[model samples]
Target: MRVVAVLAVVVLAAGCSASEPPPEDPSVDFSADDRKVTAEPFLYCDVQVKDCKRDNTAQVKLEVAPGTPVLVSVPQEVAETPWSVVIQYRTAAGEQMPPETVATFPPNKSSTFEALPPGDGDQLQTVEVKQAGAKLVRDDKGEAAAVSRGVWSAQISPPAA
Candidate 1:
């Protein structure tokens, strides 16, 4: 009887904790070399809303020493949806990548590599940012459902000559 009671209590406690909502905000950040840059990884989630502003955009610009790796750091969060992290660079020659991205459909977590610009006598002017995942959708039964998502990105460049 004592064992049974203990088992019941454990189950009840586990159920209670699981019912709690996960943290809506996760700690996500970007860096240019070792210097951290301003970022809001969830910016794309704004578009998932019904009355989102189309003009909203998130951008980060930083100048770092040559050969530094632009990086994305997400210190593990309750990621339970498709999330994307993108980073693109424009070479001094005016070229860009197809936006590095990641997505998921299940509860997940992430760590990512954004970019590494050449340390030579070259510089990056701007990084085109596009992070989109996590969404609100209509179910087959005509019900509204929410999907979770997370995203991050970074770009690097040397000082303009």
Candidate 2:
């Protein structure tokens, strides 16, 4: 009988804890060259309710070899919202390469992306993930624009010569 009571208490405690929400906000992860880093959103907002906050203090940086691919992973909170991966590269000769949006993923479509460095010995300098908010507005040209809801960015430093 005592064992049964103890088991019930343990089960009850586990259930209660499982029902509680996470203590911290979801984070984005970047992995490359056998190293991994995580970053909280420097800016985040709920577009439907127009609630937003910005933190200039948060940043994540990692060092990787040139021409290596970086893997970007997002939590469900980010994956459920439309998001895109933007990349910036630097040539081997230290010339800045034009930024490119590698791909835009629809809501709940993807949670992981492999960001490939462009050929020609270019190195990835930055990988940014932008989450589309719920609000939409028309631009000057009358085209609809989806406002940015959350941003998580990582800067990648190349190995020293």
Best by TM-score: 2
Q: Among these predicted structures, which one has the highest lDDT?
A: 2
lDDT of each: 0.49, 0.87
Model 2 TM-score on a 0 to 1 scale: 0.79
Please give each candidate's TM-score.
Answer: 0.46, 0.79
lDDT of 1 by residue, 1-161 (tens): 99999999999999888876644444456666457775554343444543332213444557765445556555444333334444444555655535433332233555554555543533444333333334667879989755433333344556667
Q: Over 4 Å off in model 1, which ranges?
A: 1-27, 41-58, 65-67, 78-80, 92-109, 117-157
User: Residue 96 of model 2: what lDDT?
Assistant: 90
* Residue lDDT tens for model 2, 49-158: 29878877666898888888899999998899889999999988888988899989998999999998887677899899989887889989999978888888898887
| Cα RMSD, each candidate | 9.4, 6.9
lDDT score at residue 6, model 2, on the 0-100 scale? 100
